[model samples]
Structure formats: structure tokens, C-alpha cells
Target: MNNFARSEKKRQHAAVDARQVLRALREMKQSERPSRVRMELPLPQAGVENDKIVYLGKHGQLADWSGGMRQRFRATRPLVDTLLEGRQANFAGLLEDAEDGVGVWACDGDITVLTHVADTTAGLLFKLLRGEYGSAPTREGAMVCVVNAFWTDGGEKVGNPWEFKLREEARDVLKAGSWEVVYCLRAVRTAAGVPGTIWRRYPEPWLVLDETGRVVLSKEGSEEPSSAEVAEALNRTANATE
Candidate 1:
């Protein structure tokens, strides 16, 4: 068989095996289960910034490593609990929040919501009335849903919107510590014909490309990228020569 056919066959076999394993696990009686089995997985750590790890590409396809800064979207403890409820409820809440003008960024591999802290809105208004607007509350954090896999009911590529679930294992892993979340910002034209920036996630480069293949950072494009992007790209170019 050709490489594409072989890869597809392998993926099908793996999916079948995974389903069988899940079935067997579910069928096992509580009394018959062993109590000594322990599972452990490596966790991503803070203070370990690897710019080369950032990937961008289409879902269900190979990703390209695009050097970028390791930006973390902070999330408070309470915000995480709400997102872990389930996909349906979380999605509903997302739409409701969006109606309130809350920001929601969604692309291929991930979806993020800029969640607010409880009572922050009312508290901010009260403070503003008292001329304390300078000290008003800021955006608490974001809820990030990292998509793991995509599946269709009819075995077709196109299907319903992707659902998210915080598995037990993932919950356990997240309990270890705080995880960094990155937000992608893009530039857009405002109603007044002025340039503005907004939170958006896209799978393509924000900067324009020159004739020599170098990126040109234009003022009309996305927000100013972090210096880390250039530094990391330079490091990789140097290493490639060596």
C-alpha cells in the first residue's frame, strides 16, 4: 500500500483498539478491578520557555513550528472549575458571555474565552461612580479549551462543531500547577477609519512577507510581535548553518 493508505489504515486500527479498550474498561466490575495500578504522565512546566514549541496549522493536519513568544493567558482557580463542567454548558455560557461583548477567540486547535471575575462588572461601575475608575477591576483571566481530537458521526471529515471535555486525567494534571495560555491579537480597521487591535486567532502569519522571504512588520497589520520571535528565529537560523 502507498504511504497515505498505510497511514490511514494504521489510524483506523488505532481507533478501533482505543474503543475496545474503553469498552473493556467500562465492562470491568468494581470488585474485579485491581487497586494497585497507577498512571503517571509528564506535565508541562512553568519557567521552561521554548519558543520553537509554538505550532500553527489546520486541524487534523500536520502543524508547522512557528517561532513565537511563550505568552500565558492567566486563569483564576474559580474560572477553571466552571469550564470543567462540560462542553454543552460551557458552550452555552460562552455564547451568553459573547452577547455581553466579552471576547471569544476560536480557530482550529483551540478556543479561548476572556472570562470575568464574579461581580467585577458591578464593582467596576460602583468604583467609577466614586471617581475610582483608575483602580477599577481588570480582566481576571481566560478559559482555554485545547482540542485533542476530532471525530465525525458518519465517518466524514465535516461534522458538527468540535466539543471539549476535561478528562479526569487532565484534571489531575492541571491540578499540579498554573498553565500558561497564549492569546493571538490581530489588527483591524475601526469605524472611524483608524487602525485597531483585537484578540483573534488565525493559522496564517500576521506580518507581510517581502520579496526576499523576510517578514515586514507593517503598522497596518497585527500588533507588534514580541522581540522573542525575532530572537528565536535568528537562533534557529544560526543553528541551521552550524
Candidate 2:
């Protein structure tokens, strides 16, 4: 082959090798990363706007209430689907069993109830309408009564402790069925810019449970916990109530 043709062939071969290496790295990363559970709820037709919904706090104004409800339905459509199908679906339950059950539901900016109980079967089933889970009738309506799981690394510099702490406090609020409380976890970005890594550290396994005692999610720190630490935090939180 001509020199120019030979050079072009070599360039093409290099490009192919690079692409193959990148694909392999991506697959490895995906396999090593923790699993995440997400549910998308449907929104009401009358109140949705610009894809953003409001979450009306318990004492929020009527206008705010309407917007939040719309957003929540839009976000949790997946969980609603499972509920309607009469499947034994519980996000928190699954997490708890997996030992990575630190769950959170975004509430789609609408009203959401975080229940103290880990079991969410009954609540999920009750929300179904004609094999579908619909939005709450009012903007002030409450979505499912459970927290979804979220995972974070504590060893990072900017990690916020509030993520897991809020789950602990949520148990108390869940018992009251009062939506007056809101927990906020803040973390400042470090020089390295790791998200949610600068806050306090928790080495325990976090859990998310439905009201029906199902563990939908669970996560442990990269460092395994001692028997005592596991028993203290996990067991205690499992039994906590609002």
C-alpha cells in the first residue's frame, strides 16, 4: 500500500482501539457503582406547568400547595405503576434487605408523607386508581408515605451528614403524620469539588423502608461496620417512630 494509505489505516486502527477501551471502562464503572431505585409519579392535568411543581409545606399557601402536588405526581409515576399492578413493590423494603436502604423521595415538589413504618405495601396499593396511581386530588394532597433511598460516600471532603441524619429524624415526623417538619442537609464544596462530602461522617448502613415493613433499599459505607455499630444504628432506626 502507499505510505499515505498505510498512515490512514493506522489512524483508523488507533481510533477503533480507543473506542473499545472507553466502552470497556464504562461497563466496568457501571458494574462497580451502587444501584439506585427511582419512581416517577404522574401529575394532574389541571395544575402542571413548565415541568416544575411546587411542594406545599403543611402550612403553605393554597397556590404553593397546588404546584407542589402537580410536581410530585410527575416524579413518582414508576412507583405508582407498581402499586397498581398489585405487585408486592416496596422501594424501601428492597433497600433495607440489600443493606443500603438510605432512601429519599423528591416529593416532586408536592405534598409527601414520610412514614415511620418501613412497610409501604398498603399505602402503595391505596394510591392506585384503575390499575394506576393518580395524583392527589388537591394541591395540598399527600403522596405515598415513605422515603426513597439515596447513597453517598462519607469519606469525601464535602459530604453532608444531614442526608442520613434527616432519615433518622424522619422517623419521628412520620409517627405524627404532621408535615410541619423539614430537614435540610448542607455541604460546602471542597477544593476538590466532591459533592456532599464535607459534612459529618456516618459509618453505618442506611436503610429505607415502606410502611409495610419492606426494606426497599440499603447501603453500607465502603468500610464495613462493627457488629455493635450495626446493631446500634440500624436496629435503633428500624424501631424508631414519629
* Overall lDDT per candidate, in order of appearance: 0.26, 0.27
- Distance (Å) between predicted and true CA of 134, model 1? 28
lDDT of 1 by residue, 1-242 (tens): 12211232222222232233223433455354321111101111234433111112212123321221111112111223332233223332332333222222221112232332122122222232233422212222212332221122112322123411223222332322222211122222322232222221221233422212333332232233444443344344444545
Candidate 2 similarity to native, TM-score: 0.19
Output the number of the TM-score-best candidate.
2
Candidate 2, overall lDDT? 0.27
Best by lDDT: 2
Candidate 2 residues lying further than 4 Å off, grouped into runs, are 1-66, 82-192, 196-204, 207-242
- Per-candidate Cα RMSD to the true structure, in Å, reads 20.8, 20.6
lDDT of 1 at 43: 13
Clash totals for all models, in order?
1, 64
Model 2 lDDT per residue over 11-79, tens place: 223223222322332244434422211111222233444322222211122233343433433333333
- Kindly report which residue stretches of model 1 are placed more than 4 angstroms away from their true locations once superposed: 1-89, 94-99, 103-112, 115-214, 217-223, 226-242
